[model samples]
Target: AQSVTQLDSQVPVFEEAPVELRCNYSSSVSVYLFWYVQYPNQGLQLLLKYLSGSTLVKGINGFEAEFNKSQTSFHLRKPSVHISDTAEYFCAVSPTARQLTFGSGTQLTVLP
Candidate 1:
């Protein structure tokens, strides 16, 4: 069985500061990782994904994630934070031929 874990429940960063939202996963089979962001009262939008080929995957809204097989981690990062970036981030994993498994979300608060 595969499971996703979000270690941080909430993260606060100042504008222009760098931030990383940690995500870890465990699975017996190969897993495709994804990062989704949900703004206030909005649906979950796909940020980035690591399906194959490159370990470093770039996504929309200046977000990126690296898939580390050995560590079973897919962590999301942004070099600089913005006020509009405040949202809840969710890490999900889909194993080969299986449905998506989601982790508890991380709330990102960008302070002025």
Candidate 2:
């Protein structure tokens, strides 16, 4: 069985504040981790991924996450967020399950 869990549904932070989005997963076998961001009505864009290398992986928009095998978690973090960072973030997993399964989602609201 494979599943993804995002602890928070919404995160409100002032502009230039740091933020962290939590994500956990369970799978019988190895899996590929991914974080995607969607702005308003725009399509989802790849934020980061954990394939088969270093635990710390960096992606676009100054976002990054570390894959913890023991904890089975991959949490996204950003040092300072801007108003443009306001959007929805989703954590996903891709095993041999045919397709990727996404988390409920985390809506990041950055206030000016």
lDDT of each: 0.95, 0.96
Tens digits of per-residue lDDT for model 2 on 50-96? 99889999999999999999999999999999999999999999996
Q: After superposition, how far is residue 9 of candidate 1 from its true place, in Å?
A: 0.3
Give candidate 2's whole-model lDDT: 0.96
Candidate 2: regions farther than 4 A off: none
User: What are the clashing pairs of model 2?
Assistant: none
Which 10-residue window in model 2 sums to the lowest lDDT? 94-103
lDDT of 1 by residue, 17-98 (tens): 9999999999998888999999999999999999899899999989999999889899999999999999999999998876
How many pairs collide in each candidate, listed in order? 0, 0
Give per-residue lDDT, candidate 1, residue 88. Answer: 100
- Give the candidate number with the greatest lDDT: 2
* TM-score per candidate, chains pooled: 0.97, 0.96
Any runs in candidate 1 off by more than 4 Å, and if so which? Answer: none
Pairs of colliding residues, candidate 1: none
